[model samples]
Target: MSRKLLKLKGAFDLRPWYQRNDYLGWIMRAKRDATKVRRLQQMLDELRAGDAYMNMAWRPRR
Candidate 1:
């Protein structure tokens, strides 16, 4: 489900390289499976919505 959303939006590709790495590293640092899942879900939601990043409003360049 997450992969589909990411792929559909080219989410990872569209973001700055450092942002992408930060997101993945943040998720990986989660000590609990639940936390990891929660972060991943949040990432997907932000990507699919096309309006936010890291829980903050973000409008992509046109």
Candidate 2:
């Protein structure tokens, strides 16, 4: 009887230098946009809720 040997394949280093740079740039831009979007959404929600304290403080008395 002969036994067959099995070999395991190793994982590939997926990104080269150029691709890594491109991905890093994309990630940074995405983070910045996400922060801005979150801030804007919070402001919109506050406005919709009619947060009286915020409105009274920001608005000038006539």
Q: Could you give candidate 2's per-residue lDDT for residues 2-58 as a string of tens digits?
A: 221111001012323453354345445555778656644443343334332212333
For model 2, the local distance difference test gives 0.36
Q: What ranges in model 2 sit over 4 Å off?
A: 1-31, 52-62
lDDT digits (tens) for residues 1-62 of candidate 1: 67686584687689878778878998999999999999988887887787888998988888
Clash pairs for candidate 1: none
What lDDT score belongs to each candidate, Candidate 1 first? 0.84, 0.36
Q: What TM-score against the true fold does each predicted structure earn?
A: 0.80, 0.34
Candidate topping lDDT: 1
TM-score of candidate 2 versus the correct structure, residues matched by position: 0.34
Per-prediction count of colliding residue pairs?
Answer: 0, 0
Instruction: Point out where model 1 deviates above 4 Å.
Output: 1-9
